[model samples]
Target: MALDDSMDRDPIHGSDDNSPDRQGRSTFVAGERTGEIGVTLSGLRPPSRSIVEISPANIARRRLANWGAIQGERVNVTRRETFEYGFQAPRHLLIAHERGEREDGETLIEGLPRSTLREFNCKLSFVPAGHKFFGWQTPRVLTRVTYFYIDLQDRLFDLESGGARPTIGPRLFFFDQAVWDTALKLKAEVGNSDPGSRQYAEALGVVLVHELIRLERATTATARLIRGGLPVWQQKRVIEFIEEHLTEDISLAALAELAGLSLYHFARAFTQSFGVPPHHYHMARRIGRARNLLQAPTLSVTQIGVQVGFRETSSFTRAFRRFTGLTPTEYRRHRGG
Candidate 1:
């Protein structure tokens, strides 16, 4: 298959005026060929391009959104259609099947086969850079899928092996709740016009890439910590301080001081004992407090966000979604608030 020369150009910020259906949807001609389906993955390359055209029968609607070089799309498959196509790129590909009725299809990437995907079953596929992958599927029912494009050269993973890049093999139908959750958040950010949406999308992209690295390195032996963990009194003091100052700008330096250790050593020892970074633990505590505040009908979302240390509602929403996979309002609603 021939590559689209236009794809080499900067991504076009599509508008509803340019859409064939004029349904207020943005559209762009991602490539010249028709075989390539779905939206172009973002962040696979700097100044990424968007895949605007998709088979009308195969895709009912698609929304393309970008965060820096990372791009994503939410696709609604309308009909059952078989397609055979290949993708060649310098970036990695992540695909998550969000929704589907009949779980009776097959996909093959570089001759590796996987059975049909089921909803929320932790099934995802990863395609590495410099690879040509072929996929064929004929869904028996309508489906919703999301795709994330990532550039390996971004140095986001920090793999740094004497300038030798680590390579990830093709993964098919794997179970990873974290990756799935991050993809869902990315999908939720698609087509959002808020000013902070891009930053939220970028943060989610970083998280997704980190999860990818963790998944790839799962089999490797972890480095041993210099010491077991923070002393018992230090751990208790830190936890209490975090709870009391949940709304303050608690810095890593301050936490390290409280723990009476260097920044690097404190971080390592904290993770060794708590199974999460200090910042992560702090965020979890904040989110936990926010959840309780959200249950109170008297407090508005903004007020709750402020009470939980977030200055902006958007940032709070993004962080909350990252932890619980739901916005504050969504969580409250589900909890019968």
Candidate 2:
């Protein structure tokens, strides 16, 4: 059959006949194509230029791509203290925070309001085409993330479906076990040279898309995080104040007034919004920022503590030990070690 005719059938399931989608197609077993349905054409040119939207500072990227369109990157934010991560691509991006913990950071996705909730280990973030995803973090440990780039097109963009697109919404810091597992499997084949690995990754990419189609904002816990939290403008203002005054003491009444809520209500709402009480969150931010400062060899432990709002070095050491199970000196040395 002609290539265009074959393209009309389900790419994964195949046409009525058991023949390959194209005439004389390579038996490399490639992944799903960004476009041009049916079995993917070998040496097929990418639909568009692949764009990676990570900052170049202190970032190391390992990229993987097959003869088709699915591209993957394992981004390692080196132990240089802190790093920023964001996405701005012509294609969709599936982000898996494989293993990373942040002491301090701001997460902003186009769909969700800005967020100050840190701890993103195993979190999943999906940024649809044309949306912006931005975040910068002061790390508590080495940060590693796998970014799976889904070629944005109309599989209508599934591998098994007709040319009609499925509804897939944007999500930030959400959880979806199916998408996460499929994305990780695809990422594992990034550098593999085995003959079947490419095809397997491609197949996994198709599976990942079907998983993404299952993302429903109302059905997920992500909506609850906001539903139980503060308003968007209030969350932004409150987080900004906390970030600006991390090295100083800020009162709850002050924050409450800022949020235009009474003291009692503000405390409850802030905790509900950020999953932590106001004071506890403030202190954590101070210590988190201090951890970042410790990475600078030029700064003395006492200076770092003072910079993060400690009146004395001893008090700073005790608080740091309380929060992180290590004194300032020990934490710094351990990080170096």
Candidate 3:
């Protein structure tokens, strides 16, 4: 995909990272100086995607591949990918939040106060070595410092947010190998030699999105049954069953039978109790599990999608994006693990 021809002249394009001069009293990276492109980011909404595609050939040459602007708002820096290209402008700092015990992978980081986001001067670069899709390195002299996982198994690092004198977020980097795997899967699946398989993979990304949007609006009570407490127990049992065999073609009929009821009765009961119907609930669980897999430092969006019942990488990505506002790569970046 050719980029906009005008991005070349944009302020984000700078040859040297050490060209900015301090005017009044502003913080700058010691030893290495970077230019600041002044811009406001108010009302800029973070991406609501859940997948990323990082292929070697395309990823090696860095460029402004995935970013958008809002009217009269601060420029937002989103999940930047690694390639050979140099600095990008309108950079925004990514603040990583700490992880919780139950948080297995990238899925644990959710419901952030986007309203409380701090800003920072930011840019991304690729490391020469490594099989992983993403990795991170702090700035050092001589070599271009690439923060966050940019190699293959990329990792995130919390940086100072807000203008030249930005404050850094608290300590905590969410590291999950699964995110790397997912990216790799997408590269392979979408880049597969078989065109039919590739199209199927792409189609899945679309389906995934449709299912996730439905899940986002779903409520806990809406997920319960009219039978009240008994429905609750059944729902739990169904969830457990689905989790155990998610890889299988588990269907509403299968689930209904598991609960010793007809498909119609089971579907209605399940929907009444859980807010979503059986298939939708199952999809929610699969997507939820997929989110956990995405947190792995090694898995890519595609790989995680496959692991969570998505046969095609694109489908997984589409679905993941719909459920979370950010793509898989974006989600991992925010988590900083």
Candidate 4:
């Protein structure tokens, strides 16, 4: 199939260790990540997603690639702190936030208004080829996400004409029971050593893509601007300011001024656009940045906390624990630093 042709040239071989291959199922290697799709997947450029896609600093990953049709990665954030993923890809990508709740954060896709909806467990997000998607969060718990990469050159074909249409629009943290179930089945197959598990996993991948096609056809109605949210230009300006000031104490009045709205209206509209109060969102971004810093040991915990705007170590630790269920020290330990 052209799917294999679209993926990285490396082939997935059976694991030599006496664990999975003997079960008569095609193997899922637990070794180096340079398997079928890892190379090109990590090769995409600037504002590099290699850290997020290949080996996130504080994440422990278990990957499964079956027949080079689809690749699935089960990611466990070792700590409950901040984390993010982003970048464009050469192929279709789907993400399942298996278990996560973000106190503050947002999902930015190329064509859609950014999504700030929190509490996104069991939610699915799709990024079409060449579209940029990035998101971050100060997790409310240790997060688990299942990522799927499908190397599909022409993702969809209209049956009547049998010609491929565009795959699908970028989806940000949406729900579709059929698609979710199929994705979950693929993730479960990661641990399955049963006979035919390989074939079963690959079959599930096909079903999952088809389910997405059905969803796309069902929703071609059109996407309208969110009535109560900020206009795109105003939103872009406000978000740009907020992002640049993540480590500073930002005033709501200042943000409102930047949005050209009165304080009360700006607060409401900002919440409508971002799904959280501006201060909460700011704090979440700070905590999230702090987490990435924790992944490296050069900085002391206290210095790291101060850098994210907490003046006192205790305050930072308390806030970090409140959001992530772990202190900076404990999180660092989990990172093996």
Choose the strongest candidate by lDDT: 4
Q: Is candidate 1 or candidate 2 better by TM-score?
A: 2
How many pairs of residues in model 4 come into backbone collision? 0
Lowest-lDDT window of 10 residues in candidate 4?
Answer: 1-10
TM-score of 3: 0.32
What is the Å distance of residue 61 in model 2 from its true position? 4.2
How much lDDT does candidate 1 score?
0.65
- For 1-337, candidate 2 gives per-residue lDDT tens digits of 1111111222222322223324332222233222222333221222234544444444654565653667888777667464545556667878898876766555566776655555678989887876666655567777788888777473324454555554567777777778888887887888888989877887788778877775663345444544577989999999999899777767677788898765546677787888877777777888899999999999999898789888788878877887899988888899992
lDDT of 3: 0.37
- Backbone clash count for every predicted candidate, in the order shown: 4, 1, 86, 0
Q: Which lDDT tens digits does candidate 1 get at residues 118-150?
A: 243336878776554443344666667777877
Model 1 misplacement above 4 A:
1-58, 83-86, 101-105, 111-122, 155-165, 221-337
Q: How large is the C-alpha RMSD of every model relative to the true structure?
A: 20.3, 22.1, 25.1, 20.6
Count of backbone collisions in candidate 2: 1
- State TM-scores per candidate: 0.45, 0.48, 0.32, 0.49
lDDT of 3 at 227: 49
lDDT of each: 0.65, 0.67, 0.37, 0.67
Please report how far candidate 2 places residue 46 from its true position, in Å: 20
Question: Which pairs, if any, clash in model 2?
Answer: 31-202
Kindly report which residue stretches of model 4 are placed more than 4 angstroms away from their true locations once superposed: 1-56, 154-162, 221-337
Q: Candidate 4 on 77-124: residue-level lDDT in tens?
A: 776665556667677788998897866544566787656566778889
